[model samples]
Target chain A: MRRRASLVLLALAVFFAALSPLVRWYAFPRLAKIPPSQYQDMVLEAKNATLLDYTTMKSKKVPEVSIVQTLKGNVAAAGKVRERTGRDVVVWDTLSYVADDKGRMVSRIPERYVFDAHSQEPVHAGGEHVDGDPVRRRGIEYKWPFGTEKRDYEYFDFQTRTSAPIHYKGTRTVHGLETYYFEQTIPWTKVKVPKKLPLGATPETVEQLGLERWYTTKRMFWVEPVTGAPVDGQEIHEEEMRWTDKPGKKPLTAFAGHVRMRPDYQKATVDLVSSQRRLVLTLTTYLPWGSLALGGLLLVGSLTLEARTRTRGRPPGAGGPPVSSAAPGDPARARRPSPAPGGSGGMAPGAVGAFTGAFLKLLPGRRPPDQLTPAARVPSCARWVRPLRDPPAKGAWDSGRATRPAHPGSPPPRTTRDRR
Target chain B: MRALLAAAAGLAAALALVLAVTATGAPPGETSKKPLHTTVPAHP
Candidate 1:
């Protein structure tokens, strides 16, 4: 009985141990991909900023300028891309809008970013990022990949339409989360005016008016490593319009600010990402290792049980099946083990009684050792093995062992001389 | 007594197996918050 149980435990341990890597490397990538239908938004504020009043064509100092950024996943677009690329994809329709304290419109940039749902690497599909200018995007943007490393990452800029290495500056505890701090500096670069300008003015027309846009920024991100989600972010952003045709024209400050996530938004982001971090760790780290540990413990338990059973289930001269343990014409002796076919046996030496069904080779699964006669009970103290044969029925007359004909399935015969 | 021990051992194995498989499930919830930002339509 004990040996059968140990075998069952050994099989279960191997099963769990084998499942560990499959959980980490296989299931995590497939299940944890960015949801293609997810939609998220954040609010950033820049205090005491400068904005160019287009009506007056002059730079004015404003009390605050706010940027509202929204990312809405395009399920249909991702589905279309996933079919061809054979990879899970996410298409994000992004909108960035700037406004003054009085809620006057400043500038708006709409973008379509496509990327691998698992790795976050940009996928250049048709008509991507922007219209007319199909800027081939590269590197990390908006968010990082899960299990982010403590090394530099190639970061992408939507405005410059280029990729640069963002250096990891060390670790930080932001909002009580241990995070990786990354920063990137972009130098001044001349850029195009918004295609969707107010008053229906075109970029060509704006260029004809000698108004050119120049921009530069220093970006910072604090990302939770497990979820690869940004808990806090900031950008020291500056933009100004200069004259290309006329050198003496006074340059207009288009926008300038040290923009940061709103305090409430930061708190919400931390709360949201913190929960996600735990889940990601569960699949990629915790579950795999936990299963492996449990498997190891089970393995030890099984081996110990087998050792103890072997030491205690065998009596003197019981290393092998006892001769004449079962008669040849006995129905129990003719029984074969399930699954492991062609085994003709009534009982195993150590496994005197057990389920002994499929794939287990013991038989005559009956009778507890405590009910056995003293000679039969000698070997069952350490191992809780039921005996192979049952006690004879009460008052039933049994022939003595000298006849060599009494069935062993019955208890040993009484020695009292019956002169009947 | 032996039957009870077998039952307890089976239960523990099932519980461990369930935990390992359930950990691979997808995270279903999403976040979408539109803050109080007033502005004219972005396009003309």
Candidate 2:
């Protein structure tokens, strides 16, 4: 019964060991996939300096205004690979609309983003890559190697239809989970500005607002480690236009402030962290250790069962066959005479003793004698010399010291008796 | 039999403890529900 149980436990251990890697490779990727119809909201506070009075030459102080944007998106597997690129695709449709304090829509933008399904790189949306170059679409949540510092990434921007270099800044704890932080700065020289101005603005005003040549955007993202999901984000949009062409003149402020992640976004991040933690713990920690513990238990049980069976078969009050009388530390103690013919009683006792002795030798502070011969210490098939129980008569044929007749014609060797 | 049962029980207990610790510990989320606002440099 115990043997059967141990075998079962061993099988279970193997099953769990195999399951760990399966969960890591197959189950985790499926769970980490972005579900369709996910909704996110971002509340941005647009700050812009307004002229208090056109007549007055005083600097204007404009209070910050709040603009809430709701983002609704769905990701779907594409039916066929693109003809030009020959890559599998996934289509993402997102609609973002700005709302006022009362939640009334002010402006709506509908965007269709197509990405390579396997690589998750943006293939076509606002612009096409030249000659099948891999466009870096950092906005997608599928980028990997989240916690490493090996390479920087080029993040694509949907609004400007450009990509900016983003570098790993450091690690930070968000909502109890460790996250990788990244920052991207688009300098004023690289910022693309529209050629035309709005209705109320003149050329002088547009130039002074830095709407012509001076505008920059800085973005930061805190991404979850395992899933590569951005949990927290901040974006700062800055633009300055000067009234004079002189180099030393201070520029007028257009818009300056950060757009922080909303609560809904934070909740999404926390959910991703929770899911990732569960998967990682199961794959890397719990399953492996559980399998090891089960295996250890099985081994101990097997050893105990074998010992019990041997003890049960031994006759009562029959002390185990006499062991060697040599001192425990003596080198001769390692050698034991072979069992006599038809003597089955000594085999089990000898096996148990050998097992114990080998086990004890593995313990710390115990050393085997150096003088012990290899034949005595290790079981082998080769014949070894053993002291005879009684010496042969002076003239009897003695194999130990016997020699063949020299060249088949030599006289027999003389014995000690003959010499005496 | 007793040894085996004891070892199995201990392992089960350890596995339970691991599951409990991992499941109960909550991931950090945003502390405040209110929106945060910050000002950036106009000229940089």
Candidate 3:
């Protein structure tokens, strides 16, 4: 029985040990994918920002500018792309709407980003574009990949409509979660004018006016490494309307401010990312380490249990014919050190019994070791290990003498009452 | 038998933990109920 129990324990240990890496490497990679149904919205604010007054063709300072960013999962689009590309793809219909404090819309850009759910790498399938213009997407956008490394990653810039390397700045903690800080500096570059501009302005009209739009930004993000979620984000965004017809002309500030996630939105994002961090940690760190530790402990426990059972079967003088091998009246039988009247309560005897006894307590209606029959104490070892004397019909407890026969050198055997 | 039950309980607990971990990774739905780009009024 004990040998079987040890085998069971060993098996359990092996299962737990194997489950760790299986979940981390095999299952996590395949199954830990971004759901095609996930959608999220965030609000960011640029305080004391400057915006160009298109009617006056001049920069105007504003108390605040709000940018509401929404990302809606395009499940139908994702399904089509997945079929074509043979990859698990996700589509996010994203919109960044900028509005003044008075709720007057300044600008809004709509985009459809498609990428691999796990790697966050662009798949470049059909229906990829920014602001109704078909364009190939490259590099990470909106989010980093899971297990983000401390290295540079190519990040997409919507203004420049290109990919640039975002350098890993350093590590920092945001809302008590460790994160990797990354920054991207988009230098002054002539960018395409907005398709639709205020005051009846369009790209053609801006070109007719000999004015070109230039943009630069220093974007910073604090991203939680485990889930690749941003806890806090900021951007020093600056845009200008420059003169292409004239030389050394000062450009009109189109929009400029240090944009930051709204305080409440930042808190909300941190809280969400914190919870997700725990989930990722469970899969990558806690579960794997815990399984390994449990496996090691159970392995040791089973080995101890098996070894004790074996040692318990052999007598002090193992050289002698095994305990029950000698006949009842044989000199070898008479010399064996017989145990006292106390029984093991259907368990192994000695210190090992004390160890296993705690687990035995889980059984219902089990008698205490001291009250059980000597026959109950006799473990289910091989027959040769049983007492030299023949067992009584109903076990030793049913017989008047509860104790086994004493060795010739020992004192007489004691009954249960005498021991009491 | 009792030890086996205890071992079985441990295994069940471990399995439950793993299940919970995997379930947490399963994205449920839209995190925010706000309407999509439709909510934005035409750019003024």
Highest lDDT: which candidate? 3
| Model 2, C-alpha of A199: deviation from truth (Å) | 8.6
Q: Against the hidden reference, what TM-scores do the models get?
A: 0.72, 0.51, 0.72
- Candidate 3 is graded, for docking, as incorrect
Give the per-residue lDDT digits (tens) of candidate 2, residues A72-159: 3333233333445554444544444433233333233444556654345666543332112323355443243322343466776644
- Pairs of residues at least 3 apart in sequence or in different chains that clash in candidate 3: A324-A384
Task: Report the CAPRI category for model 2.
Answer: incorrect
Top-TM-score structure, candidate number: 3
Tell me each candidate's i-RMS in Å: 8.7, 11.2, 7.4
> Per-model C-alpha lDDT, please?
0.68, 0.45, 0.72
Worst 10 residues of 1 chain A by lDDT: A338-347
- Candidate 3 lDDT over A208-318, as tens digits, reads 889888999999999898899888899999998888988698989999999998888788788888888787788788978898888878766765555455445444423
- Tens digits of per-residue lDDT, candidate 1, A1-420, equal 766777667666666776677678767787777888778778888999998877777899999988888788877788788788877788888878787888766767888889988889888876476534678887978999988999999998878888999999999999899999999999999987877655566788878887888999999999998888999999999998899887797778888999999888888889999889888999888989998898788766665555455434333433232222333234453352221111112222223133222222222332233344544433322111122243334443345222112443433432323211
Q: Give the distance in Å from residue A297's predicted Cα in candidate 3 to where it truly belongs.
A: 1.2
Q: Rank the candidates by lDDT, best first.
A: 3, 1, 2
**What is the lDDT, from 0 to 100, of the residue A50 in candidate 2?**
35
Off by over 4 Å in 2: A44-90, A96-109, A115-151, A189-214, A239-254, A263-268, A279-285, A288-420, B1-44
Best candidate per DockQ, number?
A: 3
Model 2, retained fraction of real contacts? 0.00
Lowest lDDT sum, 10 consecutive residues, model 1 chain B, at B35-44
lDDT (0-100) at residue A25 of candidate 2?
52
